[model samples]
Target: MLKDVPRSTSFGHSSSVGTMELIRPRASKSNAIRIRRSGFQDFRRVGRRENDPRYYRFTLKRSGRIDISVQNREFGGFLGFPTPTLKVRLERSNGKVLNRRTVRGGEFGFISRRLDRNTTYYIRISSSGESVPYRLGLRTRGGAELFR
Candidate 1:
């Protein structure tokens, strides 16, 4: 089953392509989403930029097996960027943190993290916190279809 998670959110200032975005459901128009789209700059990291698939997520209360994974891309070691920096976090309503992790640059890899099915969830990307131009997507558990 799929359902919108957050009540509402907003994006702040966007300084670069380092997009910052917040994920949630639109059904909760009763309330506005909260976000911080600020503090972005074109510092030009040493590693080169690579294209990666996006992720889409669904938040519903359930009790089944769940896993999170990420894939990193590399380009002939160009700009010495063999990996990409990432931040993954999970939270519940009332601002309770169930899990939080930082992915410090990598291409393709499994998150090896299992999520609790019977809980409210809100995922926030570390790179761009609900900012514009950022990308977020997910694949079905069977890996057959894509959703964003």
Candidate 2:
């Protein structure tokens, strides 16, 4: 049975797309919704860059699942920048960690277990001192769709 989920949320220097309110009420089988955000450079303060982390919050309105992955597109010091690095964490809204992993270079994948309905989850993405442009993708059993 489908249930109502909360849509109101607060974002800290981040953008959301696709299932903006997380997962929508599943009327019928559909393609996997994808949300993407680019974090090339964080803001700078007092002549120093702030190491603030990016956040993506979503709710599972049903027994749906998603595969989370990230990729660093910057490479070869093309712009005289260091190799891209990424660190991602998936956790419950209450601070219970579900998955945590780091990718020194290239793409990193983390598949989530079947999520319970009415539960809220968060995906946090942060970079080391060396920052570069990166992309985050979420896929599900239903085909594949991308959202800016």
Candidate 3:
């Protein structure tokens, strides 16, 4: 299955794709690296606008397709990169890197492996040989939240 997640409603064209492996990561220095609505907001009214710097939040379930769209945000390496890349690594809670892979075309897929429920996950993205980590606060998702 293929997943395409567009940030809010910026540009219908801006989107990231991932296969069953789910290794899709896109960073845009132009738009600031983010988790894309992966935060818990209890109060978001019409008057409230999503202007605060956000991170790219990917929520993967037991079985489903996850789409990562870079909408409303610009793709990283926009400075002078012709083709962009996304590097992903799963870091353990103790700060160990595991399952490292290079993903081209800003899209990735996951076949047999799915994210461990309520486990701490760390991700990094690099394009054009440049490296960047996910936002500091929003790095931990789901399981990490429950543990906290």
For each candidate in turn, the TM-score is: 0.38, 0.55, 0.31
Per-residue CA lDDT of model 2 for 49-85, tens digit only, reads 3233566665654445567766655457456655656
Judged by lDDT against the true structure, how good is candidate 2? 0.53
- Please give the distance, in angstroms, between residue 45's alpha carbon in candidate 3 and its true position after superposition: 26
Residue 84 lDDT in candidate 2: 52
Q: Among these predicted structures, which one has the highest lDDT? A: 2
Weakest 10 consecutive residues of candidate 2 by summed lDDT: 39-48
State residue 25's C-alpha deviation in candidate 2, in Å: 33
Name model 1 segments beyond 4 Å from true.
Answer: 1-57, 73-84, 109-118, 128-148
Question: What lDDT tens digits, residue by residue, belong to model 1 across residues 1-148?
Answer: 3433333234665333433444333323123223211111121122212111122234434333334443322223368744345555555654576565555443433332344444444544443222212322332242222111
Question: Each candidate: what lDDT?
Answer: 0.35, 0.53, 0.34
Looking at model 1, which ten-residue stretch has the lowest summed lDDT?
A: 36-45
lDDT of 2 at 49: 38
lDDT at 132 for candidate 3?
Answer: 23
Q: How close is each model in CA RMSD to the real structure?
A: 14.7, 15.6, 16.9
